[model samples]
Target: MKLNISDRKKKVINRMYKITLVIIGMVIVLFNDTFGRLEGFVEFLALYFILILITVAYWIFKQIKSIIQLKNEKEKTELLHLKSQVNPHFFFNTLNNLYGLMEKDSKAREMVLKLSDMMRYSIYEGDKEWVTIKEEVDYLKNYIELQDLRYHKKSDIQFSVQVVNFEVKVMPLLFIILVENAFKHGLENLEKNAYIHMNLSESNNTVNFEIENNFEIRHNSDHQGIGLKNLKRRLALVYPKKHTLTIDEANNKYKVALTIKIK
Candidate 1:
């Protein structure tokens, strides 16, 4: 019966039952003189007992339904976690085979390894609330190296890091969007003398990242992209008042700076 009834239908039926019982009780109480006083009292007691039984039954049903729902959710979560594990293993195996086929000293082989490392980090560490700064820096370097391989033009790109403690942990993938945007909106549109400069530094529990790139003025647009919007939202959620993000665009150049205070 429970399986056949929808939640909405069950709720409606429950409400109707309550209303009917209430109306019946009111009618019985109002017509007490028509029946003997003792008989009226007996009827009232029976009705009250029935109402108590119904209430207890409903409470028991709700507890059982809650337990079943929780069990189903747990099973679904476990299945998804297993699938996630399988996918990364499959991906890495394929990459390994491809890597073996390439020449030892080939740029393609190097790119494949870098790509594999990036994929591994993204799959395993990207979702983590915090990761060592060193790991994030390595991921960024691999990403930059891959980008460098794809471009035919020799755009000047530089990344510098100054950190007192490499093991200091911060939110993962915090700076990749800015770096990606630098290439997407800045370096890609420029024809000559294109440059991207990035710097990351940490001091007094504060982490700062800055990136600047030159772009063609004709290719500039006034609208903010979704990536930046999402990044801003994430910053507001994760750091609240402890983070600052600033963007400056002028003279055919785009610059972004992000500062985060972490424990």
Candidate 2:
């Protein structure tokens, strides 16, 4: 489902070539024939039928191929935009954390290396579409670990991860946004209980994701911020109507559940 730019271009070119071939062959059969016409209208009708069939076949193929290309281009464009937004937000958040750490702790320097690795994946790696679920899960774990370190004192954050299939691929940063959202409003103002629970399961060519966290009613003013709003956009663009997304906010608990079909 994730085709690179070059691959998409190649597919378009190949389809064009096939259309060209069909057209040339049709032209040859229609005009460059050796048969002399001493026949009735039925014979002419038969010839036209064959010609129309060939052209119609090619035309249908052309249309289908064009639709696929257009869809891919649209998806690619949207994903790149998501990556742009996500990379900056991620950098800003991480740098803010790092800045706070640098002000009082010397070990912040060591954590910078890990941050660099994360940045490498976000900024330089192949993030145009789906990445191996394993890679994304690992990235999520690293983020949670870093957040734990940042909130070492007076932070009661509980995080969990479950990866059922390493081979399955998912849209990049699909699950992490929920984690970030949970931390932003969940951990930032921890008065009673601050906890984040995440679970991922893959079966029947589907990915099940759930993230639940305690929500402080006070900080939930900006409920539809850039992150969650953009996340919904990304989900619509990537999964269309194939995936199911649910948000449950009740009893001071915020929960997000989405199931994506990988197949």
Candidate 3:
């Protein structure tokens, strides 16, 4: 029976019950001769009116609070939508201009195109609840290619994907943070023998990603930044107990392994 009543309904019922009790008590006081005289009775009536006014004021306050909360929610949603539209369109236009200025078949033109595709995916698909594994893999590849173009150092970066089903849906942009951190803290800091290895595989209704990179020990201070923190928070909210993230840092190496149960 309790389960049948929604929380809002239960709250309404409780408020009604409380108001009914208050009214009944007030009526009894008004009818009884406990006050002993007309003036006393009049004073009791005044007190009763005050209680009624307080009850009405409380109800009004609750209504106002609810309206404020609803307005805030609507404003937040609109702001997010506006950001999604503005940021993506701005980047798209800028990238298109850059692409046009570059000579045809040039390496810079290729990089700009790759960047445009990546930005498109990130701005449009990243906001979605989920995306196909193929889409995510393509985005990561584009990101890696763009990064590769920026650095002259010959870092041995490798990414391997073995997905049983490309159509399998997963949280968008889940692996990009780890890859970015690897490049930022690992390859960029190391002068020689820098290497990053990454693998993504899906099997038996589970998806797994692993990344290992070698970095200089002196640049380890900012390795654990807001990116990893946000990733952990998101994993906790989205996957809860269904996902596992393991981190290992030793011998001038950093490795992260993530496993998610798709089912």
lDDT of 3 at 247: 95
**Model 1 TM:** 0.61
What is the per-residue lDDT of model 2 for residues 216-244, given as tens digits with 9 covering 90 to 100? 88888765476676677777777888798
In model 1, the runs with Cα more than 4 Å from the true position are 1-105
Return the clash pairs for model 3, or none: none
lDDT for 85 in candidate 1 is: 26
lDDT string for model 3 (1-263, tens) is: 45645887898999999999999777667766776666787788799899999999999999999999979756654443333222244345546555655774367777777887887887789878789999989988987877776666888999999999999999888888889889889998989899999999998889999999999889988887866876776676668899999999999999999999988
Q: If scored against the real structure, what TM-score would every candidate get? A: 0.61, 0.64, 0.64
Winner on lDDT between 1 and 3 is 3
Better of 1 and 2 by lDDT: 1
- CA lDDT scores, all candidates in order: 0.78, 0.75, 0.81
Model 1, 77-151: lDDT tens per residue? 443333322224434554655565576436777778888798888778876768998998998898787777656
Best by lDDT: 3
